[model samples]
Target chain A: NAGVTQTPKFRILKIGQSMTLQCTQDMNHNYMYWYRQDPGMGLKLIYYSVGAGITDKGEVPNGYNVSRSTTEDFPLRLELAAPSQTSVYFCASSYEDRGLGGYTFGSGTRLTVV
Target chain B: AQSVTQLDSQVPVFEEAPVELRCNYSSSVSVYLFWYVQYPNQGLQLLLKYLSGSTLVKGINGFEAEFNKSQTSFHLRKPSVHISDTAEYFCAVSDAGGGSYIPTFGRGTSLIVHP
Candidate 1:
């Protein structure tokens, strides 16, 4: 079973191009997150959603936007792609716990901006 | 803000040899710790975690970690490693209380098991 799914496994965008990175989870988890990993670095949270119609910015939310339209979908939008935004994006979901615990991650989408 | 640090950038060990990956965290409040492994071109996989009860936690592939609250560290260890065990390991931490429990990941440690 697919826990969390991400679309466009790989994408290349022009400097001023725009695209949407799609993410969906079948776990029915209330907490969903989007993270980006740069070369030789750790995962940085871009945005997160507690549930449908609830969203918040994370550590590196600049130049990126996210919306949780439904319990299963949280799509990330990019207005103008930049080289700095080129990284592997991962979608994750976890059950809400008072003390945050574990997460199930997606296969990831590799994005490259020229 | 919660932050995690993986001391070793890379660890190289011979097959069937024991290995340890060090991790440290900094947070104002009580925190939950986790260790995740990522193989080449794949997503992170949960190896083990320390929620509250036990200090020592076991996970898949004969891996384990001990949570040292005093030192604010959770290091992963394997008695013996196989060639297939080579991968990147990440340490993460999150707040224990109310605020949105968003996880913070470390830079990651690469494990190289050579035969």
Candidate 2:
């Protein structure tokens, strides 16, 4: 199983430009999340989905949007990129809530906004 | 609401020495605690988690953590360190009684191991 996969391992975008960060999981997990990591900032949740067709805003959702159309995919969209949005993005999946089962994470996507 | 605090921003240690990384959390309801390790340019990997059962939980790479509900702490420890153990560690808490299971992560602690 591929676990969780995030695409475009590296990307550079100009200010005001937009792009999507892709995420997919083969575990058939019910929960999926998108997080951004910055120096000394750990990881901040950007968006999450409990299951297909369901999505919710997270702690730092200001510059992102997510949709869970299929059980395997949840992609994050940046309407307008900013320098502050430059960070490493990660996708994680869990089988249940409360971390009854630990989370599986993807390598990460390093985004640089200039 | 839930929050996690990693007491130290960085911890430097010599190889073969014992080390501890402190973590404290605050939450009104029951909470599930977890420790994750992140290597350079990679995602966080679960070192261990406290869902229920024993207060002490052991994880991969010879790492372990003990959950103290009274102190609201879950400190990670290792008897001996290796240079390869140098990485960023994070503490997270998920409120089990809340409607959402989204966890709150600490700012992270960088563990630098010296040879």
Candidate 3:
């Protein structure tokens, strides 16, 4: 399996711009998540999906949205980007609740909001 | 709600020296804990996990962690370090009590191994 794949390893967006960070997993996981990592802040969850068509907000969901249309893909959308959104974004997937097993993470996209 | 704390932000050690990365967590319900390693410019990889079995969990790259329920801590350790071991480590926790089962992650600890 290729595990999880994320596109556009790096990008710079102007204020008010919008974009989507794509994440795809080959493991057929039932759970997928989007998280942003800031310097010294660790990771803050933006959104997550338990399965296709089910999505929920996380700790820092503002300015972000997500959709899980298929078991293989979970994409995160950022609208009206701000400088505060500059961080490294990681996509992860798991077979079930994290209590069962840990998540598989993508290489991450480094976003710079100017 | 569950939360995790990584006691150290950075740890510098010489090659072949023993090292430990401390992590603590808080949760009212029973939790599953994990330690992950992230190399520079790479994604995180599981080092080990502690669910319901023994308190001691062994993981990849000759790393291990001990889960202490009383102290609510799961600290990663390696008897000897190598230059290749220089990377960032993260601790996370998830509980069954919540339907979301979303994990709480701690700020990463950077391990710097010198030659």
Candidate 4:
């Protein structure tokens, strides 16, 4: 099974442009997360969802919105792209009840804002 | 508030040498600790975690970490290093007392292994 999948492996957006980063998981996990990693910096949480129809803001949720409509899908939206938002975005999923196994991450989407 | 600190920003070592990446965390309540590795242009992968049980946790690729409650540290160690082990490592912490599932990650430490 495809553990986790993220689309648009690479993208370049002009200032003020907008785009959506799509994520999907086949594990039927209850927890999904969005994170962005900048150069020399750790991954910062952008958004998270405990389950379908539930979403919450994370540490760096500014300029981003997320929705969890189905168990398999959770997408992140950027209203207005900025240079500061240029980084590698990753989508992850985990089983909340089973805390032993850790999160599974997608390949990642490299976004560059000019 | 929960926070994780990876003291070293970069570590350079020769192949076949032992290496240690130091990590320290601060939290008022009980918490879960984790170490994740990210290869160049790749997503983060779980290296190991300290949820409960033994203080020492072993992970894939011959890596391990020991959780010290008193020092509030979870330092990753490897007896021998390979050039392939070069990557960025992150230390993260999350509260285990409640429904707090969000983890706070440290800035990250870059491990560079030279042959």
Candidate 5:
């Protein structure tokens, strides 16, 4: 099913620079999420979408934005990159809520902000 | 709001020895708990999860977890460890509310299996 896929396996951005992390899933999941992983920290959700055109902020939503235009695509936008934002990003999708099943995660995008 | 805590930051064990990673959570509403493993340079993968039905849930890689509602804990355990089992393990919780599906993850516990 190809599960979940993310583009730009790695990236480096300068202060104030902006970029978008692309994510797509072929499982036709109704839920999609963006998370960041720091050196010693666990994955923190940045944003999520319950369905196309419906999005919401997550625990660590500051400094980031997201849009879900289609059921298969959910992109995360970093408006002004900062060194603190440097981390590995993972995208995931699930068929239903957490009760239904576990999420399928993408390989991940490693980003470094200089 | 829901939150998770992984008691250990790092656990070192010899190969073929038993291991356990402790986890605790706090939430006012019902929650679904999960454990995910991340290998070096790899994405996080689901190790096990506890929803309803059973307090004991078995997951991939010969790992299992017991959900203790009284203690608000979901600890992952393996009968025997291997070098391949070396990875960072994260405990997570998600609200069971119909509208919220985002999960809250613990800081993470690094499991180092030494030969």
Candidate 6:
């Protein structure tokens, strides 16, 4: 079963270019999240959506946007990419549970800005 | 906002040896703690988590962690480790009673299991 799927596994964009990192999950999970992982910065939340038609900015949401118009898709958009935004982006989904928050993550999309 | 801190940046251990990776968080309210392991070029996988009851929680791959409320710590311990365990381990925390369930992750601890 394809739990979570992310597209454009690797991409190199010129400065000021914009693109969208697509993410879709077949588990029908209510919670979806986008996180960026840098070398030493660990995983920082970029955006999150609890359900369709709801989204919120996270710790490092600058220069990024997200929309959850449907339950299966939550695509992250990078507007005006910059060198500082070069990092691996991960998409995850989880069932609503207060105890033990285990997320089903997709293989991340590696993006680099030149 | 909650902050998680992994005491050690790296822990080098020989195969078949016991290992412990410490994790601590600073939060004013109740929080849920978790440990995740990330292999090379792979997404992080849940190693274990601490919810409410049972101070000691066991997880997959023979790993266990204890939630110490007074100390605000949830350190992961393994009685023995294998070479396959060489990866980066992360500690995360989320509010237990808050509305937003966003998690804050630590800097991560690299566990180098030498054969």
TM-score of every model versus the real structure? 0.96, 0.97, 0.97, 0.96, 0.94, 0.96
Q: Lowest lDDT 10-mer window, candidate 3 chain B?
A: B94-103
The Cα error of candidate 2 at residue B17, in Å, is 0.2
How does chain A of every candidate compare to the true chain A by TM-score?
0.95, 0.98, 0.97, 0.96, 0.97, 0.96
Clashes by residue pair, model 6: none
| lDDT, model 5, position B42 | 79
Over A1-114, each residue of candidate 1 has an lDDT whose tens digit, in order, gives 788899989999999899999999898898888999986689998999889999999889999999998999999999999999999999889888432557888989999999
DockQ scores of the candidates:
0.62, 0.79, 0.78, 0.61, 0.65, 0.63
Summarize candidate 2's per-residue lDDT along A37-89 as a digit string, tens digits: 98888888999999999999888999899999999999999999999999999
For B46-86, candidate 5 gives per-residue lDDT tens digits of 88888888999999999999999889999999999999999
DockQ of 5: 0.65
Task: Give the number of colliding residue pairs in candidate 1.
Answer: 0
Give the per-residue lDDT of model 6 (tens digit) for A1-114: 898999999999999999999999999998999999998889988999989999998888999999999999999999999999999999999988442569988889999999
**Which pairs of residues collide in candidate 1?**
none
- Model 5 chain B, TM? 0.95
Taking the tens digit of each residue's C-alpha lDDT, what string does model 4 give over B16-115? Answer: 9999999999875778999999898778899999998999999999999999998999999999999999999999888888756678889999999999
C-alpha lDDT score of every prediction, in listed order:
0.90, 0.92, 0.92, 0.91, 0.91, 0.91
Q: Model 5 segments beyond 4 Å from truth?
A: B97-99
Ranking by DockQ: 2, 3, 5, 6, 1, 4
What clash pairs does model 2 have?
none
Which lDDT tens digits does candidate 5 get at residues A11-56? 9999999999999999999999899999778888888888999998
Model 6 stretches with alpha carbons more than 4 Å out: A97-101
Candidate 5 colliding pairs: none
- Reference-based lDDT, residue A84, model 2: 95
Off by over 4 Å in 2: none
Candidate 1 wrong stretches, greater than 4 Å: A97-101, B98-100
Q: How well docked is model 1, in DockQ terms?
A: 0.62
